[model samples]
Target: MNIDVGILANARNECRKLLTEQVGVLGVVISSVDGFDVASAVTRDLEPAKIAAMASSIAAIGIVVSQEASLGASKSITVNTEDGFVYITNIELAGQLCALNVIANSSAILAQIIYHSGEIKRRLEVS
Candidate 1:
């Protein structure tokens, strides 16, 4: 449970890049598999702790369903609401399990989000 501050700082910086570059992004939260908020770059209205917990729950369910259905590992889960979308992706950074949760407005482009998420994953895995 003792997460390194440097790792957290890096995570936040990565998320910040995503949010700043993607105009439709509302927030980003990076959390441990156990639902602990490791780092976040979010709008003022968001509660990082709550978002992390909910995102972890969603990702866990995605993994469970994938296993039960005999599919491969769950890569990501996208939930679309009336006003926006929530995209949750499981990641491994610095050999530790983590989750990247992104909130985007209705104007967000799904393809762009998907592509950038993949790039972010690769960058995170290497760094």
Candidate 2:
């Protein structure tokens, strides 16, 4: 997807907003469906470029697995680890599909991540 300047600005704004509003969130990234980073906000020394590429691959895998199981489209993929959680979701921005990646510490509540990411997705869609 070709990144539009307006959309990239909006994405960066939203990422920063989410980081500020959430306590345990470590980073947020907006990526092209093809695995290119568009925008990101990080509180730690995280690699958004790597995360973007991985999110794209993970999303593609999720979709393939979902279809194989006849479970319909995969909504999102959540990875829970000892230190933190990684949430990978999708958003359609300016007619192009994009990936939304959220990295949070272990203290982050799952419900909040889901809720806030959903809000971010809605905003990106209409922006």
RMSD of each: 1.3, 1.1
Error of 2 at 39 (Å): 1.1
State which candidate has the highest TM-score.
2
Q: Which residue ranges in model 1 land beyond 4 Å of their true spot?
A: none
Task: Report the lDDT tens digits of candidate 1 across residue range 8-61.
Answer: 677788899989999789898888898988878898899999999999999999
Compute the lDDT of residue 24 as modeled in candidate 1.
89
Against the true structure, what is each candidate's TM-score? 0.92, 0.95
Top-scoring candidate (lDDT): 2
Q: Model 1: clashing residue pairs?
A: none
lDDT of model 2, residue 105: 94
* Superposed Cα RMSD, model 2: 1.1
Candidate 2 residue pairs that clash: none
